[model samples]
Target: MTSLPEDSPPQMSEDDRDTAVQRLQEAYAEGLISHEEFDERLHQVLTAEARSELVSALASLPEKHPGTTSTIGAAGGRIQRHGVWRVPRFLKVESAFGRVRLDLSRAIIEHPVIDIELQLGTGRAEITVPRDAVVDVEGLRTGWKDLRYNAPRRSGPGEPKIQISGTMGFGRLKIRHARR
Candidate 1:
Protein backbone atom coordinates (compact mmCIF):
# COMPACT_ATOMS: atom_id res chain seq x y z
CA MET A 1 0.00 0.00 0.00
CA THR A 2 1.32 3.48 -0.87
CA SER A 3 1.86 5.82 2.11
CA LEU A 4 0.39 9.29 2.09
CA PRO A 5 2.45 12.49 1.97
CA GLU A 6 4.71 13.28 4.95
CA ASP A 7 2.55 16.36 5.74
CA SER A 8 -0.63 14.30 5.79
CA PRO A 9 -2.50 13.91 9.12
CA PRO A 10 -1.61 10.76 11.03
CA GLN A 11 -4.37 8.28 11.84
CA MET A 12 -5.84 8.22 15.36
CA SER A 13 -6.97 5.03 17.04
CA GLU A 14 -10.56 4.65 18.34
CA ASP A 15 -9.32 4.53 21.92
CA ASP A 16 -7.40 7.79 21.50
CA ARG A 17 -10.45 9.54 20.06
CA ASP A 18 -12.67 8.23 22.85
CA THR A 19 -10.22 9.46 25.47
CA ALA A 20 -10.28 12.91 23.95
CA VAL A 21 -14.08 12.93 24.03
CA GLN A 22 -14.07 11.87 27.69
CA ARG A 23 -11.60 14.62 28.55
CA LEU A 24 -13.80 17.22 26.90
CA GLN A 25 -16.82 15.94 28.82
CA GLU A 26 -14.94 16.18 32.11
CA ALA A 27 -13.81 19.72 31.39
CA TYR A 28 -17.39 20.73 30.68
CA ALA A 29 -18.73 19.01 33.80
CA GLU A 30 -16.06 20.66 35.97
CA GLY A 31 -17.04 24.12 34.78
CA LEU A 32 -13.69 24.48 33.10
CA ILE A 33 -15.31 24.88 29.70
CA SER A 34 -18.55 26.47 28.55
CA HIS A 35 -21.28 24.51 26.78
CA GLU A 36 -20.39 26.02 23.44
CA GLU A 37 -16.70 25.29 23.95
CA PHE A 38 -17.45 21.68 24.85
CA ASP A 39 -19.53 21.29 21.76
CA GLU A 40 -16.82 22.76 19.58
CA ARG A 41 -14.07 20.64 21.08
CA LEU A 42 -16.27 17.55 20.84
CA HIS A 43 -16.99 18.24 17.21
CA GLN A 44 -13.32 18.68 16.48
CA VAL A 45 -12.57 15.40 18.21
CA LEU A 46 -15.30 13.53 16.36
CA THR A 47 -14.37 14.82 12.94
CA ALA A 48 -10.60 14.88 13.31
CA GLU A 49 -8.89 13.03 10.50
CA ALA A 50 -5.42 13.10 12.07
CA ARG A 51 -3.52 12.88 15.36
CA SER A 52 -2.56 16.56 15.36
CA GLU A 53 -6.20 17.51 15.01
CA LEU A 54 -7.10 15.42 18.07
CA VAL A 55 -4.31 17.03 20.06
CA SER A 56 -5.55 20.48 19.11
CA ALA A 57 -9.01 19.59 20.38
CA LEU A 58 -7.63 19.02 23.87
CA ALA A 59 -4.66 21.39 23.83
CA SER A 60 -5.69 23.91 26.43
CA LEU A 61 -7.43 21.54 28.86
CA PRO A 62 -5.71 20.97 32.21
CA GLU A 63 -4.70 17.44 33.01
CA LYS A 64 -6.12 15.71 36.06
CA HIS A 65 -3.91 16.23 39.11
CA PRO A 66 -1.95 13.10 39.76
CA GLY A 67 -0.64 12.22 43.26
CA THR A 68 -2.22 15.35 44.65
CA THR A 69 -4.46 13.58 47.15
CA SER A 70 -3.52 13.46 50.81
CA THR A 71 -5.19 10.95 53.14
CA ILE A 72 -5.41 11.33 56.91
CA GLY A 73 -6.84 8.50 59.01
CA ALA A 74 -7.49 7.72 62.65
CA ALA A 75 -8.66 4.42 64.06
CA GLY A 76 -10.17 5.68 67.33
CA GLY A 77 -8.54 8.90 68.37
CA ARG A 78 -8.33 12.57 67.59
CA ILE A 79 -7.12 13.68 64.17
CA GLN A 80 -6.28 17.28 63.59
CA ARG A 81 -4.52 19.54 61.11
CA HIS A 82 -4.09 23.10 62.22
CA GLY A 83 -1.97 26.20 61.74
CA VAL A 84 -0.05 27.07 58.61
CA TRP A 85 0.10 24.13 56.21
CA ARG A 86 -0.01 23.36 52.54
CA VAL A 87 -3.30 21.90 51.50
CA PRO A 88 -3.45 19.44 48.64
CA ARG A 89 -5.88 19.49 45.76
CA PHE A 90 -7.78 16.56 47.30
CA LEU A 91 -7.80 15.45 50.91
CA LYS A 92 -9.35 12.31 52.42
CA VAL A 93 -9.94 12.18 56.17
CA GLU A 94 -11.08 8.98 57.87
CA SER A 95 -11.71 8.39 61.51
CA ALA A 96 -13.24 5.38 63.22
CA PHE A 97 -14.14 7.12 66.49
CA GLY A 98 -13.18 10.48 67.93
CA ARG A 99 -12.86 14.11 66.96
CA VAL A 100 -11.31 15.44 63.76
CA ARG A 101 -10.42 19.05 63.16
CA LEU A 102 -9.03 20.68 60.05
CA ASP A 103 -8.18 24.33 60.21
CA LEU A 104 -7.64 25.95 56.82
CA SER A 105 -7.83 29.49 58.02
CA ARG A 106 -4.11 30.04 57.69
CA ALA A 107 -3.29 27.20 55.35
CA ILE A 108 -1.82 27.66 51.92
CA ILE A 109 -4.38 26.87 49.28
CA GLU A 110 -3.06 27.21 45.77
CA HIS A 111 -6.00 25.81 43.87
CA PRO A 112 -9.22 27.54 42.85
CA VAL A 113 -11.14 24.55 44.25
CA ILE A 114 -10.33 21.75 46.68
CA ASP A 115 -12.16 18.63 47.78
CA ILE A 116 -12.22 17.19 51.28
CA GLU A 117 -13.61 13.67 51.54
CA LEU A 118 -14.57 12.53 55.01
CA GLN A 119 -15.32 8.98 56.09
CA LEU A 120 -16.02 8.91 59.77
CA GLY A 121 -17.52 6.04 61.73
CA THR A 122 -18.35 8.12 64.82
CA GLY A 123 -17.56 11.45 66.50
CA ARG A 124 -17.44 15.08 65.49
CA ALA A 125 -15.50 16.77 62.68
CA GLU A 126 -14.84 20.47 62.64
CA ILE A 127 -13.49 22.41 59.68
CA THR A 128 -12.45 26.04 59.66
CA VAL A 129 -12.11 27.55 56.21
CA PRO A 130 -10.74 30.83 54.98
CA ARG A 131 -12.83 33.93 55.50
CA ASP A 132 -13.42 34.43 51.79
CA ALA A 133 -13.88 30.78 50.88
CA VAL A 134 -17.16 29.14 49.90
CA VAL A 135 -18.07 25.64 51.00
CA ASP A 136 -20.28 23.12 49.22
CA VAL A 137 -21.40 20.07 51.18
CA GLU A 138 -24.18 18.87 48.93
CA GLY A 139 -22.23 15.70 48.14
CA LEU A 140 -22.00 14.72 51.81
CA ARG A 141 -24.21 12.01 53.31
CA THR A 142 -24.74 11.85 57.05
CA GLY A 143 -26.46 9.42 59.36
CA TRP A 144 -27.91 11.47 62.25
CA LYS A 145 -26.39 14.87 62.72
CA ASP A 146 -26.68 17.35 59.90
CA LEU A 147 -23.84 19.63 58.81
CA ARG A 148 -23.66 23.03 60.47
CA TYR A 149 -22.44 25.82 58.26
CA ASN A 150 -23.66 29.38 58.19
CA ALA A 151 -23.09 30.77 54.72
CA PRO A 152 -22.36 34.40 54.25
CA ARG A 153 -24.98 36.67 52.69
CA ARG A 154 -22.74 36.99 49.68
CA SER A 155 -19.28 35.82 48.74
CA GLY A 156 -16.59 37.92 47.14
CA PRO A 157 -15.15 37.15 43.75
CA GLY A 158 -12.00 35.01 43.18
CA GLU A 159 -12.34 33.14 46.48
CA PRO A 160 -11.73 29.43 46.52
CA LYS A 161 -14.59 26.94 46.75
CA ILE A 162 -14.20 23.99 49.09
CA GLN A 163 -16.16 20.85 48.32
CA ILE A 164 -16.72 18.46 51.23
CA SER A 165 -18.02 15.03 50.29
CA GLY A 166 -18.34 11.38 51.41
CA THR A 167 -20.23 9.66 54.26
CA MET A 168 -20.44 10.28 57.95
CA GLY A 169 -21.82 7.47 60.08
CA PHE A 170 -22.49 9.52 63.25
CA GLY A 171 -21.69 12.82 64.99
CA ARG A 172 -21.87 16.43 63.96
CA LEU A 173 -19.90 18.42 61.39
CA LYS A 174 -19.42 22.09 62.09
CA ILE A 175 -17.85 24.31 59.44
CA ARG A 176 -17.04 27.90 60.15
CA HIS A 177 -15.27 30.70 58.34
CA ALA A 178 -12.32 32.45 59.88
CA ARG A 179 -12.91 35.70 61.73
CA ARG A 180 -9.64 37.29 60.77
Candidate 2:
Protein backbone atom coordinates (compact mmCIF):
# COMPACT_ATOMS: atom_id res chain seq x y z
CA MET A 1 0.00 0.00 0.00
CA THR A 2 1.07 3.59 -0.59
CA SER A 3 0.76 6.47 1.82
CA LEU A 4 0.38 10.16 1.02
CA PRO A 5 1.38 13.15 3.09
CA GLU A 6 -0.78 13.81 6.15
CA ASP A 7 -1.04 17.49 5.25
CA SER A 8 -1.85 16.83 1.63
CA PRO A 9 -5.50 17.22 0.57
CA PRO A 10 -7.23 15.85 -2.48
CA GLN A 11 -5.45 16.55 -5.75
CA MET A 12 -6.93 19.39 -7.79
CA SER A 13 -7.31 19.51 -11.57
CA GLU A 14 -4.48 20.96 -13.64
CA ASP A 15 -7.01 23.08 -15.47
CA ASP A 16 -7.94 24.71 -12.20
CA ARG A 17 -4.32 25.57 -11.58
CA ASP A 18 -3.99 26.84 -15.12
CA THR A 19 -7.01 29.05 -14.64
CA ALA A 20 -5.51 30.44 -11.48
CA VAL A 21 -2.34 31.20 -13.32
CA GLN A 22 -4.29 32.95 -16.06
CA ARG A 23 -6.05 35.09 -13.46
CA LEU A 24 -2.70 35.97 -11.96
CA GLN A 25 -1.40 36.90 -15.37
CA GLU A 26 -4.40 39.11 -15.95
CA ALA A 27 -3.96 40.79 -12.61
CA TYR A 28 -0.30 41.42 -13.36
CA ALA A 29 -1.15 42.80 -16.78
CA GLU A 30 -3.61 45.09 -15.08
CA GLY A 31 -0.76 46.31 -12.83
CA LEU A 32 -2.19 44.60 -9.74
CA ILE A 33 1.25 43.20 -8.93
CA SER A 34 4.83 43.74 -10.01
CA HIS A 35 6.74 41.26 -12.16
CA GLU A 36 8.62 39.86 -9.17
CA GLU A 37 5.39 39.55 -7.11
CA PHE A 38 3.50 37.96 -10.00
CA ASP A 39 6.27 35.42 -10.50
CA GLU A 40 6.17 34.50 -6.83
CA ARG A 41 2.36 34.19 -6.84
CA LEU A 42 2.45 32.20 -10.04
CA HIS A 43 4.81 29.69 -8.43
CA GLN A 44 2.43 29.34 -5.50
CA VAL A 45 -0.61 28.93 -7.73
CA LEU A 46 1.07 26.29 -9.88
CA THR A 47 2.14 24.32 -6.82
CA ALA A 48 -1.24 24.35 -5.07
CA GLU A 49 -2.27 20.80 -4.21
CA ALA A 50 -5.90 21.12 -3.15
CA ARG A 51 -8.76 23.06 -4.74
CA SER A 52 -9.10 25.10 -1.58
CA GLU A 53 -5.46 26.05 -1.85
CA LEU A 54 -5.93 27.29 -5.37
CA VAL A 55 -9.11 29.14 -4.36
CA SER A 56 -7.21 30.88 -1.59
CA ALA A 57 -4.44 31.72 -4.02
CA LEU A 58 -6.95 33.57 -6.17
CA ALA A 59 -9.27 34.93 -3.46
CA SER A 60 -8.80 38.44 -4.72
CA LEU A 61 -10.35 37.54 -8.08
CA PRO A 62 -14.05 37.93 -8.83
CA GLU A 63 -16.38 35.13 -7.90
CA LYS A 64 -18.73 33.45 -10.34
CA HIS A 65 -21.60 35.76 -11.19
CA PRO A 66 -25.18 34.77 -10.42
CA GLY A 67 -27.53 33.55 -13.13
CA THR A 68 -31.15 34.49 -13.64
CA THR A 69 -34.09 32.14 -13.31
CA SER A 70 -34.10 29.29 -15.84
CA THR A 71 -36.92 26.94 -16.80
CA ILE A 72 -36.06 23.56 -18.36
CA GLY A 73 -38.81 21.42 -19.80
CA ALA A 74 -39.13 17.99 -21.38
CA ALA A 75 -42.21 16.38 -22.83
CA GLY A 76 -41.65 12.81 -23.98
CA GLY A 77 -37.93 13.62 -24.30
CA ARG A 78 -34.79 14.10 -22.26
CA ILE A 79 -33.39 17.18 -20.52
CA GLN A 80 -29.91 17.10 -19.04
CA ARG A 81 -27.53 19.60 -17.44
CA HIS A 82 -24.04 18.32 -16.93
CA GLY A 83 -20.41 19.48 -16.82
CA VAL A 84 -19.66 23.12 -16.04
CA TRP A 85 -22.79 25.29 -15.96
CA ARG A 86 -24.17 28.29 -14.16
CA VAL A 87 -26.95 27.24 -11.78
CA PRO A 88 -29.67 29.83 -11.53
CA ARG A 89 -31.26 30.94 -8.28
CA PHE A 90 -34.69 29.69 -9.30
CA LEU A 91 -35.18 26.61 -11.51
CA LYS A 92 -38.52 25.45 -12.87
CA VAL A 93 -38.52 21.88 -14.25
CA GLU A 94 -41.26 20.24 -16.29
CA SER A 95 -41.25 16.65 -17.47
CA ALA A 96 -44.16 14.64 -18.73
CA PHE A 97 -43.53 11.00 -19.69
CA GLY A 98 -39.90 12.02 -20.18
CA ARG A 99 -36.57 12.04 -18.38
CA VAL A 100 -34.92 14.98 -16.60
CA ARG A 101 -31.36 14.91 -15.34
CA LEU A 102 -29.77 17.79 -13.46
CA ASP A 103 -26.08 17.20 -12.75
CA LEU A 104 -24.58 19.74 -10.37
CA SER A 105 -21.26 18.19 -9.51
CA ARG A 106 -19.25 20.72 -11.46
CA ALA A 107 -21.91 23.43 -11.71
CA ILE A 108 -21.19 27.02 -10.79
CA ILE A 109 -23.65 27.65 -7.97
CA GLU A 110 -24.13 31.37 -7.57
CA HIS A 111 -26.57 31.26 -4.69
CA PRO A 112 -26.04 29.28 -1.51
CA VAL A 113 -29.71 28.34 -1.42
CA ILE A 114 -31.54 27.26 -4.59
CA ASP A 115 -35.26 26.87 -5.19
CA ILE A 116 -36.46 24.14 -7.57
CA GLU A 117 -40.08 23.64 -8.57
CA LEU A 118 -40.66 20.37 -10.38
CA GLN A 119 -43.78 19.45 -12.35
CA LEU A 120 -43.06 15.83 -13.07
CA GLY A 121 -46.01 13.88 -14.41
CA THR A 122 -45.55 10.21 -15.18
CA GLY A 123 -41.86 10.77 -15.92
CA ARG A 124 -38.51 9.91 -14.38
CA ALA A 125 -36.34 12.55 -12.76
CA GLU A 126 -32.77 12.27 -11.54
CA ILE A 127 -30.74 14.92 -9.76
CA THR A 128 -26.99 14.43 -9.55
CA VAL A 129 -25.04 16.61 -7.17
CA PRO A 130 -21.73 16.76 -5.38
CA ARG A 131 -21.38 14.53 -2.34
CA ASP A 132 -21.49 17.45 0.07
CA ALA A 133 -24.80 18.91 -1.11
CA VAL A 134 -28.04 18.68 0.90
CA VAL A 135 -31.32 17.71 -0.80
CA ASP A 136 -34.81 18.21 0.54
CA VAL A 137 -37.78 16.41 -1.02
CA GLU A 138 -40.49 16.53 1.63
CA GLY A 139 -42.37 19.20 -0.25
CA LEU A 140 -43.10 16.81 -3.12
CA ARG A 141 -46.78 15.94 -3.35
CA THR A 142 -46.71 12.37 -4.58
CA GLY A 143 -48.40 9.15 -3.48
CA TRP A 144 -45.66 6.84 -4.77
CA LYS A 145 -43.28 6.83 -1.85
CA ASP A 146 -40.35 4.49 -2.27
CA LEU A 147 -37.48 6.41 -0.81
CA ARG A 148 -33.76 5.67 -0.55
CA TYR A 149 -31.52 7.86 1.56
CA ASN A 150 -27.78 7.28 1.72
CA ALA A 151 -27.00 10.17 4.06
CA PRO A 152 -28.74 12.78 6.12
CA ARG A 153 -29.37 16.12 4.43
CA ARG A 154 -28.37 19.33 6.16
CA SER A 155 -27.41 22.89 5.25
CA GLY A 156 -24.21 24.72 6.14
CA PRO A 157 -21.40 26.72 4.69
CA GLY A 158 -20.02 25.42 1.40
CA GLU A 159 -23.05 23.14 1.20
CA PRO A 160 -25.63 23.64 -1.54
CA LYS A 161 -29.10 23.84 0.00
CA ILE A 162 -31.66 22.74 -2.58
CA GLN A 163 -35.36 22.92 -1.80
CA ILE A 164 -37.65 20.70 -3.89
CA SER A 165 -41.37 21.43 -4.17
CA GLY A 166 -44.40 21.19 -6.50
CA THR A 167 -46.48 18.34 -7.93
CA MET A 168 -45.22 14.88 -8.89
CA GLY A 169 -47.25 11.92 -10.09
CA PHE A 170 -46.54 8.37 -11.24
CA GLY A 171 -42.77 8.83 -11.47
CA ARG A 172 -39.54 8.28 -9.59
CA LEU A 173 -37.55 11.17 -8.12
CA LYS A 174 -34.05 10.11 -7.24
CA ILE A 175 -31.42 12.27 -5.59
CA ARG A 176 -27.88 10.95 -5.54
CA HIS A 177 -24.24 11.90 -5.75
CA ALA A 178 -22.38 12.15 -9.03
CA ARG A 179 -19.77 9.62 -7.95
CA ARG A 180 -22.48 7.06 -7.27
Candidate 3:
Protein backbone atom coordinates (compact mmCIF):
# COMPACT_ATOMS: atom_id res chain seq x y z
CA MET A 1 0.00 0.00 0.00
CA THR A 2 1.30 3.44 -0.86
CA SER A 3 1.71 5.92 1.97
CA LEU A 4 -0.41 9.02 2.01
CA PRO A 5 1.11 12.22 0.64
CA GLU A 6 2.86 14.63 2.99
CA ASP A 7 0.11 17.10 2.33
CA SER A 8 -2.52 14.56 3.19
CA PRO A 9 -4.65 15.30 6.21
CA PRO A 10 -3.70 13.72 9.50
CA GLN A 11 -6.05 12.27 12.08
CA MET A 12 -6.90 14.65 14.93
CA SER A 13 -9.39 13.80 17.61
CA GLU A 14 -11.94 16.33 18.81
CA ASP A 15 -10.13 16.66 22.10
CA ASP A 16 -6.89 17.47 20.34
CA ARG A 17 -8.52 20.05 18.11
CA ASP A 18 -10.22 21.62 21.06
CA THR A 19 -6.95 21.72 22.96
CA ALA A 20 -5.28 23.42 20.04
CA VAL A 21 -7.98 26.04 19.95
CA GLN A 22 -7.54 26.58 23.67
CA ARG A 23 -3.84 27.11 23.16
CA LEU A 24 -4.54 29.72 20.54
CA GLN A 25 -6.82 31.50 22.97
CA GLU A 26 -4.15 31.37 25.64
CA ALA A 27 -1.58 32.77 23.29
CA TYR A 28 -3.89 35.62 22.45
CA ALA A 29 -4.53 36.20 26.11
CA GLU A 30 -0.81 36.33 26.83
CA GLY A 31 -0.34 39.10 24.25
CA LEU A 32 1.78 36.83 22.13
CA ILE A 33 -0.62 37.08 19.21
CA SER A 34 -2.24 40.26 18.10
CA HIS A 35 -5.95 40.54 17.69
CA GLU A 36 -5.71 40.17 13.94
CA GLU A 37 -3.51 37.10 14.16
CA PHE A 38 -5.66 35.63 16.88
CA ASP A 39 -8.80 36.11 14.86
CA GLU A 40 -7.22 34.59 11.78
CA ARG A 41 -5.81 31.58 13.60
CA LEU A 42 -9.05 31.00 15.49
CA HIS A 43 -11.02 31.11 12.27
CA GLN A 44 -8.65 28.61 10.70
CA VAL A 45 -8.87 26.32 13.69
CA LEU A 46 -12.64 26.46 13.72
CA THR A 47 -13.06 26.12 9.97
CA ALA A 48 -10.40 23.49 9.49
CA GLU A 49 -11.99 20.42 7.95
CA ALA A 50 -8.91 18.21 8.11
CA ARG A 51 -6.37 17.26 10.71
CA SER A 52 -3.49 18.58 8.62
CA GLU A 53 -5.22 21.92 8.47
CA LEU A 54 -5.48 22.00 12.22
CA VAL A 55 -1.85 21.01 12.61
CA SER A 56 -0.84 23.76 10.25
CA ALA A 57 -2.95 26.27 12.10
CA LEU A 58 -1.37 25.35 15.44
CA ALA A 59 2.18 25.19 14.13
CA SER A 60 2.71 28.90 14.69
CA LEU A 61 1.37 28.77 18.26
CA PRO A 62 3.54 28.51 21.32
CA GLU A 63 3.82 25.38 23.42
CA LYS A 64 0.62 24.64 25.25
CA HIS A 65 0.40 24.36 29.01
CA PRO A 66 0.65 20.81 30.29
CA GLY A 67 -2.69 19.42 31.25
CA THR A 68 -3.41 17.29 34.30
CA THR A 69 -6.31 15.01 35.05
CA SER A 70 -7.86 15.39 38.49
CA THR A 71 -10.60 13.38 40.07
CA ILE A 72 -13.15 14.73 42.56
CA GLY A 73 -15.43 11.93 43.67
CA ALA A 74 -18.17 11.97 46.25
CA ALA A 75 -20.51 9.48 47.81
CA GLY A 76 -23.38 10.57 50.05
CA GLY A 77 -21.63 13.86 50.60
CA ARG A 78 -21.22 17.26 49.04
CA ILE A 79 -18.26 18.38 46.95
CA GLN A 80 -17.72 22.07 46.45
CA ARG A 81 -15.05 24.09 44.64
CA HIS A 82 -15.32 27.75 45.40
CA GLY A 83 -13.28 30.81 46.32
CA VAL A 84 -9.89 31.31 44.74
CA TRP A 85 -8.61 27.86 43.74
CA ARG A 86 -6.46 26.51 41.00
CA VAL A 87 -8.52 24.92 38.26
CA PRO A 88 -6.90 22.05 36.46
CA ARG A 89 -7.08 21.37 32.75
CA PHE A 90 -9.18 18.26 33.06
CA LEU A 91 -11.30 17.21 36.01
CA LYS A 92 -13.07 13.88 36.50
CA VAL A 93 -15.84 14.57 38.98
CA GLU A 94 -18.05 11.77 40.25
CA SER A 95 -21.04 12.27 42.47
CA ALA A 96 -23.19 9.37 43.57
CA PHE A 97 -26.03 9.95 46.01
CA GLY A 98 -24.43 13.30 46.77
CA ARG A 99 -24.16 16.82 45.47
CA VAL A 100 -21.37 18.61 43.64
CA ARG A 101 -20.88 22.34 43.23
CA LEU A 102 -18.08 23.98 41.29
CA ASP A 103 -18.03 27.73 41.57
CA LEU A 104 -15.65 29.53 39.25
CA SER A 105 -16.65 33.06 40.04
CA ARG A 106 -13.49 33.68 41.97
CA ALA A 107 -11.43 30.66 40.93
CA ILE A 108 -8.02 31.01 39.41
CA ILE A 109 -8.14 29.58 35.91
CA GLU A 110 -4.66 28.70 34.84
CA HIS A 111 -5.65 27.43 31.47
CA PRO A 112 -7.77 29.06 28.82
CA VAL A 113 -10.24 26.22 29.01
CA ILE A 114 -11.09 23.41 31.45
CA ASP A 115 -12.83 20.14 30.70
CA ILE A 116 -14.87 18.37 33.34
CA GLU A 117 -16.12 14.82 32.98
CA LEU A 118 -19.03 14.80 35.38
CA GLN A 119 -20.53 11.49 36.48
CA LEU A 120 -23.59 11.79 38.62
CA GLY A 121 -26.17 9.40 40.00
CA THR A 122 -29.20 10.31 42.10
CA GLY A 123 -27.38 13.51 42.92
CA ARG A 124 -27.02 17.04 41.64
CA ALA A 125 -24.18 18.88 39.95
CA GLU A 126 -24.30 22.64 40.13
CA ILE A 127 -21.72 24.73 38.32
CA THR A 128 -21.71 28.46 38.89
CA VAL A 129 -19.64 30.83 36.85
CA PRO A 130 -19.13 34.53 36.69
CA ARG A 131 -21.29 36.54 34.37
CA ASP A 132 -18.52 36.67 31.81
CA ALA A 133 -17.40 33.06 32.09
CA VAL A 134 -18.52 30.73 29.34
CA VAL A 135 -20.05 27.29 30.00
CA ASP A 136 -20.48 24.54 27.44
CA VAL A 137 -22.12 21.16 28.14
CA GLU A 138 -21.99 18.24 25.77
CA GLY A 139 -21.67 14.46 25.35
CA LEU A 140 -24.20 13.44 27.97
CA ARG A 141 -25.69 10.03 27.28
CA THR A 142 -27.84 9.75 30.35
CA GLY A 143 -31.07 7.82 30.61
CA TRP A 144 -33.70 9.02 33.06
CA LYS A 145 -31.35 11.81 33.96
CA ASP A 146 -32.71 15.24 34.68
CA LEU A 147 -30.57 17.89 33.01
CA ARG A 148 -32.04 21.30 33.40
CA TYR A 149 -31.16 24.75 32.11
CA ASN A 150 -28.33 25.01 29.59
CA ALA A 151 -27.84 28.70 29.07
CA PRO A 152 -26.07 29.84 25.94
CA ARG A 153 -22.56 31.20 26.40
CA ARG A 154 -20.44 33.12 23.93
CA SER A 155 -16.72 33.02 24.70
CA GLY A 156 -13.88 35.08 23.29
CA PRO A 157 -10.14 35.23 23.50
CA GLY A 158 -8.74 35.63 27.04
CA GLU A 159 -12.04 34.36 28.42
CA PRO A 160 -12.44 31.23 30.49
CA LYS A 161 -14.45 28.39 28.98
CA ILE A 162 -15.62 25.29 30.80
CA GLN A 163 -16.46 22.25 28.71
CA ILE A 164 -18.37 19.70 30.81
CA SER A 165 -19.17 16.25 29.54
CA GLY A 166 -20.05 12.79 30.92
CA THR A 167 -22.89 10.63 32.09
CA MET A 168 -25.60 11.17 34.64
CA GLY A 169 -28.07 8.64 36.00
CA PHE A 170 -31.34 9.88 37.44
CA GLY A 171 -29.44 12.96 38.49
CA ARG A 172 -29.51 16.66 37.70
CA LEU A 173 -26.96 19.07 36.24
CA LYS A 174 -27.52 22.76 36.71
CA ILE A 175 -25.29 25.44 35.17
CA ARG A 176 -26.05 28.95 36.28
CA HIS A 177 -24.41 32.34 36.12
CA ALA A 178 -23.86 34.43 39.21
CA ARG A 179 -25.74 37.67 39.58
CA ARG A 180 -23.61 40.75 39.79
CA lDDT scores, all candidates in order: 0.86, 0.72, 0.75
Using all chains and alpha carbons, the TM-scores for the candidates as numbered come to: 0.70, 0.57, 0.60
Instruction: State, as a TM-score between 0 and 1, how close model 3 is to the true structure.
Output: 0.60
Best by TM-score: 1
Clash count of each predicted structure: 0, 0, 0
Candidate 2 local lDDT, 1-180, one digit each (tens): 112223545677776777677667646644567899788778888777777777666666543334545899877789899999988877999888788889888999876667678888877788887777777777678747544446545434678777777777887878887663
The full ranking of all candidates by TM-score, starting with the best, is 1, 3, 2
Q: Runs in model 2 with CA error above 4 Å? A: 1-67, 152-156
lDDT of 1 by residue, 1-180 (tens): 111234634677787787688668657756889999999989999998887788888888887667888999989989999999999978999999999999999999998888899999899999999998989999799998998999987788989899898999989999999998
Clashing pairs in 2: none
Residue pairs whose backbone atoms clash in candidate 1 = none
Q: Given candidate 3, what's the lDDT at residue 154? A: 57
Worst 10 residues of 3 by lDDT: 1-10
- Lowest-scoring 10 consecutive residues by lDDT in candidate 2? 1-10
Name the weakest run of 10 consecutive residues (lDDT summed) in model 1: 1-10
The sequence of per-residue lDDT tens digits that candidate 3 reaches over residues 120-150 is: 8877788887667777776565658666765
